[model samples]
Target chain A: MNIDMIRASAARAEGHVRRTPLLNSHFLDEIAGRRVWIKPECLQHTGSFKFRGAWSALSSLNPEARAKGVIAYSSGNHAQGVALASKMHGAPAVIIMPKDSPRLKIANTRAYGAEVVLYDRAGESREEIGAKLAEERGLTLIKPYDEPQVIAGQGTTGLEIAQQAAEAGIENADVIVCCGGGGLTSGIALALEAEAPSFRVRPAEPEGFDDAARSLAQGKIVGNARPLGSICDAIVTPQPGDLTYPIMQRLAGPGLVVSDDEALQAMAQAFNRLKLVAEPGGAVALAAALFRGDEIEGDDVIVTISGGNVDAEMFERALQTRG
Target chain B: MNIDMIRASAARAEGHVRRTPLLNSHFLDEIAGRRVWIKPECLQHTGSFKFRGAWSALSSLNPEARAKGVIAYSSGNHAQGVALASKMHGAPAVIIMPKDSPRLKIANTRAYGAEVVLYDRAGESREEIGAKLAEERGLTLIKPYDEPQVIAGQGTTGLEIAQQAAEAGIENADVIVCCGGGGLTSGIALALEAEAPSFRVRPAEPEGFDDAARSLAQGKIVGNARPLGSICDAIVTPQPGDLTYPIMQRLAGPGLVVSDDEALQAMAQAFNRLKLVAEPGGAVALAAALFRGDEIEGDDVIVTISGGNVDAEMFERALQTRG
Candidate 1:
């Protein structure tokens, strides 16, 4: 991938995406024997880093394309991101979400003025409905991943982290990103590889959904027969994306896995000590770093916290389980 | 009274106190019919703005005084603040907390390396025990409020807000702060009154604990005979401090009250929209602006979020009630 092209894409989406603070964690520093910094995409507009990619893809469109509108297929962060970004650009958005998706996410997406089309994931594929709707309505289909512009947009987070970490006198650190389709991890890894070569990019995923980790080990893309039974519902993809797989293969430093219990404990730690309401998926990288200790090195480590849109009831249940 | 003196105290405590962000709120702007910003002291080291005052007090001490240690009397934020501040300053801290205080607070204070000194608030005065201990152990008693250095320290938050608002191109805005003993409100008012004369400072207290508002109106400090039944446990003080009352009388713009339900609703709103885990006390000023919309008249408004040390169960319940 061309670094300058990625940087240009990042510049285009700069104002649209929040320059979220890279927060320092005193508690994580003590436990991990490393200086830990969190890139809080959880604080981003629409509560996720998916906004970066969504805005990048939508904004790259010409006037005619934008006028035709955009369509996305996801029940999670990407849906909200695309909806909000399209709304910001005055372009209509149609999000095909699973009917069983969390009410909070659905409400949030619709609140951003996106036309939500609920479909049963068990009965029908969201892709089929989303593609059909896009074709029928003359709308642009914005893929959640597997797009160059989207990858370039996600790269901006890494760019910001590298800049901020350098300013903080953190010369080299492990940048841990939670992986599903590998958009976030691949983008971040490519950016870090080009800008801060000293910084290692580690992809962290839940145990059951370890496709990225397994793929990295096998030097090829891998697929899982069953989805992850982890609380990190956002990164439960069974396979990595075609575009992101090769990038991850080249740029990823290491891949790590953490259990559901570890992720829950890490989420609670973030809530109590850091005062950050990170979702289970968002807490996975930090969870892996803290739980799978020897996998990471150096005194300084940066974890890309992907989102903060966990269901309130689910958060309560997680807290109760902690007790 | 001396602005330079306050600035010096702030500078002395800069490293110890968190330079909390003045966050922009899109949700608040849409709901309140104005651009809203939040100074999130809730994410401070001890989960409250009290940490700034306590840290300032401890840091300003002479070498001899530092060696002797510090003591404080409180069942909430103040206790935790003093404990954490003293620990940061490498001084022994003894917190005289009410015996009936929540187990969580006791655990927090102890976690910060303070010696927990429980006193029977029903039978004996906590102040008496604190004073006795201070005298016997040669430890300086750090009052929660009513201290010049502490007030000056709290004033730093206002200073930063003024600077941040200016940077954000907000020339004039109404700054609302939650009032307890008027420490935070008075300090913030004084800072804004001096540095940003165009800006106005308002005191927002929970409905039942409207002593600050009552006293402001009557031009004399008045105590609430009955305990407030608000969920904002941190700001349920019965009276304003002597030092804070006079400062507030001279500098405070206005006084307002918000209901417990409003505070809880605001907390839920902050969690969902801003991804902030603010406790009830922290959300009061925002709640005042949100619930009592008719009284406010400004294009820009800044609300001070005081703390985020809410119990997980309490937070869960609040979410369920207002989610």
Candidate 2:
């Protein structure tokens, strides 16, 4: 919510989190016609920046509350983040996932020592199931992005970006972020506003599932008509969060959109040039940075590969894009 | 070389070289049956630790010598490393590579601003061509390994490992390294012997191309009868270097070898669990750690993924090994 709170979260999360490096390649620069810097959160603890927020929220809980347990509903990166964070904290977590979720994700979440409860996506309401389960098990429900602590946790990434940019001799540039419900985008926008005001944050979304882009354009929350069809399944929220939209509206630049193919091509580029694996959703910001360069200004541009949890088949397809 | 020389190289290469992070995965630990820490130089600039040595050798040169540029003979990682480093230092580089080398490697080396000269592996001697070119162009020949400054540069990796292990609370462990002409392995051995005495360096090689292992067993340098057949071409050298053999004989532990299949499997595991791209040769140390656990001791082990320059087809083959 604020710089102080984000700094506090950073303090709480220090030593527990990996300070991932800021990666760059001249090959990527050629594509964008400018110097391109990548903050590869794909190399983070849970292969995503979500772990920062997860650890922040879980660690801030009272000793007794943490001992009781926590619960959340996510089928992908957030599920794995909360699972690993809770396990590391010596606490239990119950993740409510749709039964139709990828088996690899469900298996990965469980492998991290969390209890996964699957419900039918068409027939069951995750909220009702989550609320009942939380009540029955005395578990705290950790919202994926809406809560203040979670946003502050995600904001810690922005603090790192500010410092890393300074280290890279970058005074001003647009910081592109992959956006789902505006949690990461808004958090980074707030942190950079306080710490590196010359730097601007821009939300990047996959086309056809670009709720964040539409919302920012209209100066209000707008819902996507079809969110389930995008290959960037990791970031397909129906609408921007009420809490995060205002922060993004006030601090962020115009949102950028790239097609799923662009995301795949970006994934291939990350793999070939930077030697980093990036899931399609995680690669959307990089895709925008490379393919939507006209909309992004400055001699330098920084973007985040927010996650790298794609399945093998999807990754193979990405590699084929380059071929 | 001594620790002081390595220290000087580290200082010279400080801002230019990326201090790649030490990454870990609990899943890798479970498979290895012990704690496994990964020093992923695959994330280094140029996607390999060769850049460290390249930068060190180039920067250590006198202004006049460096201005005349440099030459090296390598068809893969080392060629790219020297090219990028020379380019960055405002110096030209001439790389002599085999005509049969992968087109991707040849193209990448040239793209880094180096002039590539192709010679037939079966018909022409690269060393003779290299010597003629260096003498004619006034170019300093930077050997891929077996050179004092180059070894000192590679030794910087060991210095980082010692510090990172100390931070991770590891007092004693086997530090596994992929071995070629023993530049990296011997350099790390000499370094750990001085800095972290409890840490033992072990050379890892693909089976049948185990010259380092056979040499260490016989207490002398031994050449591989056939070195051109292995998929792990990155770390396949005919014999350990004269300069590096003595250092390894004095400070390194027994060498370990893994099958090419195992190396591919390790590469897949790196992709799945650590979100890292590990070419066949780079994955050998990790393969030995995970699949040859009986040859190692103690509760902890460290391994390096030395480089990641595999072409798309090779990486796909690695992915298939897991399936």
Candidate 3:
């Protein structure tokens, strides 16, 4: 899709979602040896960027389809996003979530007035469960990343970055985004490619789950070999989506990965300097920005802190982590 | 002194300090039973609003004083603000800090290239030390809250709030401010009185350290009966400043106070829903907003999350606090 579609999606999502703040820090800048601007999605509705695409998808649905409701599968962020968006639209949503997802995430999702169906991650396929739920309930299945509307909705972040960067007098920036299934990364890449060609989007993932990095390097879609346990649960999708992969493949630069420890350190630094509560998974881009500064070739960099739905225990541990 | 001065300060301080975003939360709105717009000063430079007034004070100084340098005494935030601002303006800064201040705060102030002299809180008066140093060094004393330029600098935040609230279509609001010595509160009150008179400013303080609240009620400055061993270290000033007390006395509504436990709860809630790391003092306004919803008379409310410079252990404890 073109920038026009993304702009239209931003217009549609306007007034429904928060225009989250863009923050700058001289301390972070000193560490990166460049001007570091941060877009904290932790402040977004449901504490993540998922709500952007969720609002886009649900709002795009026809009145009949909206009344019938929608179905989604997520570990946490996406579930809450979809639930809150659906509720705001007076529609019902059923979310198929992994049984092992963090309790805080599950509670937040339920608190948003959605029916949550917990399933075994190893035994049940979320896509299949979502499809079944949609068929059984006469609801539309809203794929988290593969849909155009969702991608367009996520592109609104790119539009905001471009607009905010321009306001800050920045013409060139290396944008680092936390990647799960390439939805946020690809959408941002497309928007930047259209609006700010001088700016580049770089995706960062956890060490054992760098599917996006592998896929970008090999010129094809790639999948993680196994679901290695990690603290960064938010961006551990097995593979990128079909629609999101191509845009990311075309527009994104070399990808980056950080250890879980590095992510924890990033979270702590974010709390100390930026005063934003970022979950370990949400801090991947910050980890990359802090550790992989040699790879950045721009005078300015934008790091996306994509989520903050971390449990209290985990957040406390993150706060105690030292770089 | 007025909106014009506040506007000029906003303009003067525009490029020096960040125009921190004003955030709106439906979740917070639900809790308050009104439109809750949050102006989180926790995101400002030096992780607090002190930087604003510091910059205004140092920048407005005469060439002779600016060249000679400046001196100040503060627990933490104001020290960092003055040090950074003085460094930026090519002036030397001597900061007198309490011996037992947070190690993180001491390290941060020194990181900005200031001479840090720690004095025993129980033995020495910071003001006397600061005055003595200013004489020996021929340095200007930048009082934290008692000066006009500093107050004007703090007023920049008020101008931003008024401008941002207007953009959000909020005409009248009960603006809750975390009160220390009334610098920020009085500055905001002055600005709001001139630019957004329908909107009222209310000062919120931690229990046992509610000197501002007591002084406002008595129509005269009143110090705490005893040294309050409070968790809200940032706002534990002896009493309101002579310059700040009058403005707050005339403009602010009846003040509110929250217990230390309530402050911690507010910090936890801010972390979970607002993705902000607020110190105990910084959170008093939010604590009032969350627990004292009955006192708010307007349809819209704005609460300022003032600072986020808490120690890691304290933040960890706050996260574990369930309310």
Candidate 4:
């Protein structure tokens, strides 16, 4: 939660991760009655903010662990991020993904030069398989959200936003970030709380996966009432992680939920007007800002577009939904 | 053209025009046997490089001219650019478009606060009608191309690329730009010919509208032998303009052409791999790099994506073509 540690992590991971631009959202601004700014992590290498955490975590590994390579279990952005980051560090990576994971994500991870091992979500426990692989291979397991270095690495995005907003002459802007396991929201909240104390950090959750919001209200982690169902595949985790829940509780301003239709509409608007191909998960923050504008408080709002790994079919459908 | 004047125009239009990003093309680079960089002007304001030209042209107008408003004739990107730019400058704009122009473009221009005046391309002369309207309304006519200020504005893109390349440690990258009325190529050539003299500036022309290529070789402006036919609607100009042709004669390197299929494939690839929504014309340079790799000389080749204002139906069809 220290700003200095987060800054150091940012400096350490400089060339490894891209400083994705904070672009102005003209259409969103007009619709929401506020000046909208987008932090396009969708443009980040590996097509998500996960790379920041993966690189930070991997880079902090000891020589012995590094020599043994790394293993991760993720069906989406985190998989690609680990694959690419591990390759950059000259360590082999093996990603365990659900058999039903999108072919695009699988292809992208393979393209990044990683070995993809698919398992049935219904029949197998990915964590167990990942741990078994790590144990047998004498490799390190880089958890997507739980690790301290990973959280700190993700915090750098908030640090960059604070710096970028200041440079853009924005003194205090509300930040709406999509939440799933809460790694990104927690990291961003921690960073903002330390540096830009006046800035409000809100967690935008998909309708069924409102654990973070529930947890915040109860002052503890909360499990989903039912399995998640949404086109926003990336942020459908069952619950927030132990490491991220406390941080979200401490700094998260308010939690909001957006429907699948809202996410799709936001995705279409982003593609047409901003010319940015945001995945459904990436567009959730924007969806909340546009569809639930009354819940937000501020003239200047910054939303995090967390990834851009959507396939053609999905994009076409999203656009159709908008029409 | 004076390099200082171009530089000054670049400085004047700096904040008004976006400094579009130069994207890495991993798939094209592998296929082309070299590194490929894509300058994504498709992501520019109003979804085209025309924004640069329009903003530059409109901003340079005298107070009296500004008060009188402006008129432009274009079927695609130019119309949208002029509409948006004129609105930004507080000058009313009237756009003369073919009655059959894509409904999306017509709607976009209207949404940008421009008056849409449709004409039948087969019957009435658009220029004559546009000029008459300008004369009657006391509005200034803003030609889409064949104008110094418009060329200077487009030159700002080249200036940005040259500066960006230098910063990336690329001293002599090959730059491939799509050519229509030759305004973009001429302006880019003028900028690179002076700023990055060692770099080769190649013009990518659609197979049907090779007027710029033919004109360059014959040492004069040349008309297409047949009517232009290409999916790349934005660059289907039948002839090169007098102003742009001479500039192309003085500054352009060899011009290259690609088939309709090739352009479609490039557009699909841009959407799939780069997560960029590029219109057909915007993808022509990429198509050239993918299909005509042997003709290009350097290990580093930069392709300019001219615009991203395609009809949604057409985009869906193009994506389906890949299937």
Candidate 5:
């Protein structure tokens, strides 16, 4: 969780991943009641910021372990991230996914040349399956957000934000991020604290799965009541990771939460105003920015849209849904 | 249309308009069956490249004319562009719009503080109305694409493409643009011919409204038999503009056309892969690059997504329809 570690990871990812642009819109500025800058990681490889972490983890592995390959468990973004990362490194990968996950996610993970193992989300533990597969196949396990290397890798996004904002003459602003396992939030928090100390990362989450918000407020780890039914499937984690909480607790601000309807509205706004396709989970931070504008300080605000791997029917439903 | 005029327009538009980013994706390259670079003017001010031309035209007005205000006619994008540009210059504006234009476009145009006058697309000539209003009110007329300053302003998009592509190590590309009065196409053609001599601009149009394509092939201005009924309403011009034609006829490559369904497919693919919101007309060039891969020359191609001001229902239909 140091600046040097994050800088090293960014260097490794420079030529490997897409250097996504930082977007700005006067339309978005009016919506959030401030100068708004959007960092659309929805354009990232694998359509999410997860690929950065995946690549970091893969790069940190020993040659022997890399030769043996890796195993990862994720319902969507992380699975595709690891799959693509492994392919880039010429390593085989096994992705443990939920049987009920979106068909598009599953198909994409496989298309990236990963072996897919489907397990019932409610009846089976993906952790158990991943551990067994790793042990049996002599493969390394790449945790989605808990690993130090992965966190450092994800921190590159914060570095980009700092550089881009400075280039655009933004002195400082609150950087809001969509929170899932708190990995992205914590990573950005650490990076911004080191690179742009005046800024803070505010975690954004769905109403029912606001564990990160509760955890930050209470100054401890908190778990969700239920995570199965949230339409923001990409960010419905059970709780924040142990490794990630300390960074978030120290460097992050009060977390923000928006209802599913609000997220839908944000997605539509992103599509219409920013012309960026953001999934529900991806739109949560934007929803918080637009809905919770009063809590935000300064005239400029930066929000990162984290993913866009939405199903066709679900996106249509979101388009039809009103806040 | 000369280099100096485009450079002057770029200078005037430096701070007043957005310098849109050039977007690239390996996923899009795979779809086009070649190296693909996207210059997304969809993220431009007012959500389209029209604002560039509008700002250029408004900036070129004499101080007296600027104070006297301006009048323009457009189906949608140009109306918003003019309204915003006029507001920026403290020039009052009157926009003559068709009654059948999207409600969102009309509302946005008015929101920019312009007076709107609706007329029938079938029975009324917007040009005549605009001229009459200009004559009566002592307001300067801003023809959408026939004006030299407007074309120079639109050519900024081409200048940006050339600079960004060169930075990305692309020496030359066949640049495809969504065509409407041949303004965008001709503007880019002039810029690329001067700045990136090896490259050429290619106009993209809807299935039936391939006026620019016909004009290029015939070496004369060719009008569409009927232009009112196309899904790509933003780019359904009756014929190439008088001033814009010769530039397109000389500097543009053989033009490209796509059906409504193919444009929808391109829109869907843009959302799914590129994570950009592209209206039907804006998606035509990408559609041509995707569906007509064999017809396109070289392994590298550049496509401009001209706008993203689609209505919600239209976007929903695009996401749902499969070619």
Candidate 6:
């Protein structure tokens, strides 16, 4: 929630988090008509920036609480993040996931040493299952996005961007982020506001699931009509988090939206140019930087490829897109 | 080349060369049955570590000679590396390549502002064409390997490994590298010998093109029967280099070789576990580390993915391999 909290999170997460390099390509610069810098969080442990938040939250727990265990409800990136974090901490974890989730994700989460409990997405409520389990086991529940420590953990990425941008001689530019419920977006906005005031955060989302953009435009939280169908399944929250919306409204620039095709093209370009595997959701910010350059200003732009946990079939489709 | 020359090259290439991170995955560690650390030079500029040698050679040139121009004969990663280095230095580059080279490589080299001169690999001598062009245009011919400056440049990767190993508390381990003409292998050997003598260097090559291994076993340089056709085209050299062979004999351990299928499987594993795109040639060391672990000793092993310039078709094939 504050710079001090983020710094403390950084202190706690040191040695655990990978300091992902700031990647760039001349080809990407030409496409954006400006210098394009990429922060590849996809290379982070658990293959996403979510590890930062997960570690932050887990590390902040009191010894007794941490010893008891933790529980989370996610079938995707968050599940893997929390599972790995808990495993590293030697704490047991129970993850509530939809039975219909991708087998790869389910296997990956279990491989990280988490006990996965499956529920019917249409019939059983994940929250009810998670709450009952947590209460019975005396386990602490780790929310995916709308948590103070988690936000602080995600903010560590912004700190790295500030340092990396300085190393690249970039003083001012827009920092585009792939937004879901706004954990990463608001966290980065807060970090940059304190560390690099000249830089602004801009949320990027898939067209139909652009609740963050609409929320920012309306100066209030807005909900998407449908969030489950976007190709960018990694980032398809129905609305902005109450804790994150105000921070983003106050500290971020306007949000940007791109189509699924644009995200796929960005993924192809990332694969061909940067040699980084970026999932559809991860490529949205990069998609905006490449194809929606006119909406952004300044000579330099920094975008994050937030995650890379795509199935081979979807990655093949992304690779087949025009680069 | 000695460690001092490598240190000098690192100094000259500072700011221009990327300090690629040492990436690791728990999954990869489990498969290798040891802690596996990956130095992804594939994420380096121009999609390979060749950029290090290219930039080092270019930056070491006298102002007049550098301004005159440069030329290189390669149809793969080396071509793109030299092209981009020359362009960055504001020097003209004339790249002589085989007409049958992949269209992506040719186009990518040209996109870096180099003049691509296509020749028949079967009938004509690229050396004669390159010599003629260099003489006519006062262009310096930059050899792919066997040059002291280029070897020193590649040695910088070892210097980094030495430092990174210290940070990781790794004092003794086998440092595996993808080997072609032994430039990278010898360079790294020399660097580790001087900087971290406890660490050993091992060269990894494709099975049929395992001349480096055969050379080391025979106590002399040996040539492969055929090198023109291999899935690992990037590292399919006829034999070890004259300059590099002696260094490898003195400083490196025994070489390891992996089959094409093993390399493909390694690439697929990298995509799944590390989110890194690795070409077959680049994945050889990793392949050896994972599939050939019985031959290697130690609780920790470090492998380098030397490049990521594989074509989309090849990448798709790699993705299809069983994880």
Against the correct fold, how does model 1 do in TM-score?
0.92
| Best candidate (score: lDDT) | 6
Location of the lowest summed lDDT over 10 successive residues in candidate 2 chain B: B314-323
Docking class of 6: high
Report clash pairs, candidate 1. Answer: A35-A299
Q: Per-residue lDDT of A183-264 in model 1, one digit per residue for the tens?
A: 8988888888888999888889888788999999999888986875768888879788999999988888578998888888
- How many clashes show up in model 5? 0
Candidate 1 residues lying further than 4 Å off, grouped into runs, are A13-16, A24-26, A30-34, A62-64, A99-104, A118-138, A167-172, A227-230, B13-16, B24-26, B122-125, B227-229
Reference-based lDDT, residue A166, model 4: 84
lDDT (C-alpha) at residue A302 in model 1: 90
In model 6 chain A, which range of ten residues has the least summed lDDT? A219-228
- List where candidate 6 sits over 4 angstroms from the true fold: none
lDDT (tens digit, per residue) of candidate 4 on B142-208: 8888888899889888898898788777865779999899878889988988889988888898887
Per-residue C-alpha lDDT of model 2 across residues A1-323, encoded as one tens digit per residue: 78999999999998888888999998899899999999999988889999988999999999999999999999989999999999999999999999988888898899999999999989989999999999998999998888888899999999999998998899869999999988899889989999899987999999898888888888888899975889998888889998999999999969999998999999999888888999999999999989999999877899999999888889999999952
Worst 10 residues of 4 chain B by lDDT: B21-30
Highest DockQ scorer: 6
Which of 4 and 5 is the better model by TM-score? Answer: 4
- Sliding window of 10 residues with minimal summed lDDT for model 5 chain B: B19-28
What does DockQ give for each predicted structure?
A: 0.63, 0.82, 0.79, 0.57, 0.65, 0.93
| TM, every model | 0.92, 0.98, 0.95, 0.94, 0.93, 0.99
How far is A151's C-alpha from truth in model 4 (Å)? 2.4
Chain B TM for prediction 3: 0.96
TM-score of chain A of each: 0.96, 0.98, 0.96, 0.95, 0.96, 0.99
Comparing 1 and 2 on lDDT, the stronger one: 2
lDDT of each residue in A161-222, candidate 3, tens digit only: 98889989988789999999888998899899888889989999999899999999999998
Worst 10 residues of 3 chain A by lDDT: A101-110
Off by over 4 Å in 2: none
Candidate 5 regions exceeding 4 Å error are A59-68, A120-125, A132-138, B25-27, B62-64, B119-125, B135-138
